[model samples]
Target: MASSPLGRPTRGTTGTNRLRRNDRWIAAADAFRRAADPLVVDLGYGASGVTAFELATRLQRVRADAEVRGLEIDPARVATATAQLEEVRAGATSFPADLRVSFARGGFEVPLPDGRRAAVIRAMNVLRQYDESDVAAAWRAMAARLAPDGLLVEGTCDEIGRVASWIDVDAAGAPQRFTLSLRLADLERPSIVAERLPKALIHRNVPGERVHALLVDLDREWDRAAALSTFGATQRFLAAVSALRDQGWAVQGGRSRWRLGELTLPWAAVSPLP
Candidate 1:
């Protein structure tokens, strides 16, 4: 029942695999697989529908009946993406035919055909244009349209998908966890992701804050783990995260996720700037 303040349109930059990290995480989450209604919405999928098509392909591996709909505020983008979808279909591009990917013109209202409720909504890089104050309201608005037990994955990422962070929100609009995914090769400090943090924590990366301290500590551990570089960047990152856990931070997940360049922490550990 809420709505965005409706800011000016974005440049609509997009590309294939730009959201691969988020898509892969969503596909593996129990939230998507357990849903009776396997409808997923790719909100504000930019000028291209490549991410939406990729989302459908990834989700279908878990829920074969899954459907992905790409929503854009600009009608022209919607039309363009629709035409592209037709071409892919006509060429027998090996996409999930039963997945039924489509595009529609809609803003944060998330207009869906037949008033269907979504089992999951992935709104990546869509809110970077809005003021931080609008984030909670936007989450409430979108989460309200989710089916019971649905999830709302909202966050931002850098170009080329090298660094990304997202918050997992429940149907009640409460943030459950924050996940940061990055590429560890040519390694710099892990905290470099502070620049790419979600809108909520981007500005909170300063002294005295938990996020700031977390990043600081992560950098320290990363330096200490530099000795593990002999094994590889992945191994060094695993060691850094392990050190973070040993330091009593409520870091979640295990080596499997860490090896994939991801680190998920409880939201309470790093809320937002005051």
Candidate 2:
């Protein structure tokens, strides 16, 4: 399939495991597990296609036939990634022998062969450069490329992968959930994610916005739960997130997920102000 330009270029700053947190979430999501097509789109994968290759490898654990397509707006980035894929085939680089990952020069339009749409479009750290007003339109454009039951996982993370947050937008183009994934071992506070908020809620981190309120309360709870730090940071985080739900914070996920320093809440809780 030929790729057509549809989005802007990213700074192409990507590292070995910069997006591991986001990849884990996508791997465990229903979007990856239940897709009949099992095609994953790594939208705007920066300078290297390593992340997309990683996604394809990890996702194979869930769906053996899962294919990953790394899409980039820059032809040069695509060329570089394609060459890397060739090295993998040549056994010159460390990649799975049967990994099914391809490099395509496409944007949010998600060009794919045979009119196929992606089961999951993971656009991590790609929206940070866009104005907040451009977020919804960008989302809709990507959502439009999803299959009937496909998903759009879009968010941002810190340079070293300590902090991250994402939104789960469904096939119908409506956002359903917002998730905060932190590297508890390296995290200083729950509010550390404030700086990494998804484009939709970054600027809304003020007093009046719902997202501001969520973070403010979360930080307060994080401090209050410091007493539990004796048990471990994980316990402290669990207590804090449970407290948020107890106080009607609309938190999602259960203890199993919370144990990993993840707190999911309905998107309504942090949607940009109307």
Backbone clashes, each candidate: 0, 0
lDDT of each: 0.85, 0.89
Off by over 4 Å in 1: 1-8, 92-99
Best by TM-score: 2
In the range 1-274, model 1's lDDT, one tens digit per residue, is: 1134233455698887889999999998877889888899998899988899999988887878889988887778889989889877786666654547988777666777777889999999888877888888888888988888999999988888988899999999899998999888865878878878888778789898888988899899899988899999999999999999998989999999999989999999888646
lDDT of 2 at 245: 95
TM-score of candidate 1 on Cα atoms, chains taken together = 0.94
RMSD of 2: 1.1
Worst 10 residues of 2 by lDDT: 1-10
Per-residue lDDT of model 2, residues 1-274, tens digit only: 4446877899898888888888888889887898888999999989998998888888998889999999998999999999999988887877886689999888877888888889999999999999988888888989999998889999999888878899999887789999998987756779889999999989989989998898889889999999988898999899999999999999988998998889998889888778
